[model samples]
Target: MRLNRGLPAVASSLLLALPLALAGCTSFGEGSEEPAAASATPTEVEAAPIEWSDCDAQIQPLIEGQPGSERDLLFECGRTEVPISYDEPAGATLPLFLVRATPAGQTERIGSLVVNPGGPGGSGADAAIGLALTLPQDVLGRFDIVGFDPRGVGLSTPVDCIPAELKDRVIASEPRPTTAEQLDDVFALSREMADGCAEEYGDALGTFNTVDTARDMEQLRKSLGDEQLTYLGYSYGTTLGSTYAELFPDRVRAMVLDAAVDPDTDVVADAEASAAGFEAGFDAFAENCKGLIAGCPLGDDPRRFLEELLAQAGGAPVPSSEEGETRQATPGVVLTAVQAALYDTASWPQLAQGLRAARDGDAKALFSLADELTGRLEDNSYSNLLDANLAVNCADTDEVVEETEVRRLVAEWSQAYPLFGAGSAAGLFTCSVWDAERTPVPERDAAGSAPILVVGNQGDPVTPLPGAVDMAEDLESGVLLTWQGQGHTAYPKTDCITAAVNAYLIDLVAPQDGLTCPA
Candidate 1:
């Protein structure tokens, strides 16, 4: 339910999305210079190797496993201060935390592979650890796997704009506000979130946009001592990476963007597309459930069960069964849990279990899923995920769809996409109330960049297939690789996708354009 303006972060393969309050306004804060340099070449800088330290402490909190277990590569953590607004490189700066999983034993070097796991708010530091453990040996052998928390995310002096209480209200708010009273509440909440974040962050809120993040990438490249940038971006990471290619196309040696975000879609368009995607993904989940033997947790009709639960939850939240758990499975929370499952088919079975539990009057499973997707912490505190998600999403776009327009879309889309559209249409208002300075994400051709590989999964619920298609079409040298697979991203899933991506990152060889791999 986090009505973000841009695409949500990935949770399973690193993207997570939820309903969170977000807004936009203008101006770089005091001591600001100008926005990031858009010229293809980076500013003159001497090579400065990253100062590394033990990262096990920072990375352990985000993953599962015994403490300090020996692994292929011990992660080394570090940070570099980058301008809060590139317009003022020496002005107020934020520490961009980085984690490097030094390859176990190197063969031939292909430079560092800078990886971003899609959150515009997701933790690249965490992704580096996970990928270090699981990325193909071939990729590891040829490159140093490095990931950084984009400014205002995770360890990067995260954006903590909204108060904890307000964030809870935002999460628990209605998913589909039908009546005038309900709709008004939505607007009021939007205003509250926007005003609060603006008051809290001031002009610095405007600096969290993607273009600036791309500029930060350039700074990171120079700091890493790489002559050229090699990158692997997933989901929204594709957006950031593409912006990098567009800005510093010549600085790029190679890039692989999986589960691409369309460079051209606006807030409303993205929400509508999300509705259609989730609906399709749900259908697939339902169809798969039908094929299971006697153990299909969802009985005869999955959609009906979901609708009934949602309708019931709108009036009274379902109670969770976990011994000390207090969070109720309200319609917004319930829908978020369902949407979370749609990200990966691997989660569908768990989704079924959660639904069955809800039907049986014990909804902790559903509540837990929602908690995870929204980055709710075990201590009942939330991560800065939603706050940063809002800041970046709102900062990236300049569009301002009015309340009336959002109402119209909700009315039309609800009937068109029964389960997901109505609520998602409300996302359009997320940025409308925002008063922050906006830097619109540019449509890119990435002219003169090295061949960039763009991969798409047919069943990705968050960033749909068309985003990849549009991304490939948008890049001058982009090559398209399609996977008839199910999940939020297509990478290291099947041998075909892995080999192609590895080859590209390793040898700068791209799979044939329009290449398709069977699921």
Candidate 2:
């Protein structure tokens, strides 16, 4: 299936409280509000749990037909124009794109449930429309699942920097900046791309960070004519959800942040945690594959196979197909593929199968699996979202280092994770070269919001489970819901999580403090 971030620890950590930017020149969420004339009573609609009647009639038929599967899902795109800078409402205008599924039946809509799938770069508008059929039935029934291409993402006025071939080249390269020249080359290339992105996207690229996106969410909520905003954000989306809750607690109807990031840490810490997570994932793979050598051909010694792959690929890249298309097939790719596979245990067998193919001298299977991990499938073009990923990450984070400093950081991280840390550090080099202005530090606390739910997976590798616990501790109203699961986000993998979250959405039934479930 689709990738969920990575192992329980890292994937979940990144999901917990990651803060990043979005595309679009807009003010961060800030504005004056008039006092309510009177306190409003809770509607009966709010008291009942999610019911079929809650779903908007306008969007049901489209759900019956798988949109992405058919490619027939009509994209109803609209723009929400917001101020370039929230601090200066008139500085400039940035338009955001919104996509919705038409309700299947002819009934008045109840409200909209906005979605953000994460990545600081993930496109919710595409996901909502494309995956409409697969969402939890109760969720679909109650509210119109609305998705928007966050300011700097797909379908929105996007950021285009590096050429597609160049991006692929970079992504396919080894993650290690072993030589000084190699490190310098990495820095120079990233700097050039960052400068190019800013030159192309202009001031809008500078403003696409997470805080602004959170504000955009508020504006979108207002534009939709909803009294309260209900939302589901996964991966980096958890940051968006938490930020919104902090900024506008009173406006929150319900929200579910699956696989959350630690809200209080700097990006350096996030990256470090993510590295550890990958190691955890590798361990999980080793554990599961050890006894199944006949099916899992990386051999019973996971570490040995991983090391051998890295050494071999690092010395000489492997051709992915007979056409001579090549990739390093290093541990990073193996780990990336493994991370993607960990999203659903159902894919464990597939990963094993790919490993078997690689062992047999057919690298195509491994390459194909790695492609899915990096989102570089044969039919799909490289996304500028990767540029946006850097832009927004640089803009929102307090952690930025020069090449020298990055090298030091990478060295330290490598010690912590001998297998994958160096590569991740090298991969994140783009942030150093990005020109987007930094926000200085996490801004959610100053936003002044509510107790948002932060979910974590016990074995999460990317966004470690501790990240969620840490995030919960940071927020005044934050509550922790731990899932003893293996994926990035808990909701998709477990019915228990869905039920708890649905209860929160429909009847304001928050799970008890520190609620947890078994893997």
Evaluate residue 274 in candidate 2 and report its C-alpha lDDT on the 0 to 100 scale.
76
Candidate 2 lDDT over 148-194, as tens digits, reads 77876765556557676666666555565566777776676677777
For candidate 1, what is the lDDT?
0.77
Q: Whole-model lDDT, candidate 2?
A: 0.62
Worst 10 residues of 2 by lDDT: 42-51
Q: CA lDDT of 344 in candidate 1?
A: 74
Candidate 2 TM-score versus the reference: 0.81
TM-score of each: 0.91, 0.81
**In order, what lDDT does every prediction score?**
0.77, 0.62
Off by over 4 Å in 1: 1-49, 57-70
Model 1 C-alpha lDDT per residue in residues 1-519, reported as the tens digit of each score: 342212232333221221110112122333334344333333543333556777555444445463222455666777676766554555555667787877667888777889988766887866777677777888888888898888888767677777777877877888777777888888888889889888876766777778888988898998988999999888888989999999889999999888888777877788888899888989999988878986678887899988888888877888987888887788888888888788777778989989888877778888777776777866687777787888888888778898899899989998999888877888778888887778878779999998999999888878888999999999999999999988788888899889888888887789999999999
**Against the true structure, whose TM-score is highest?**
1
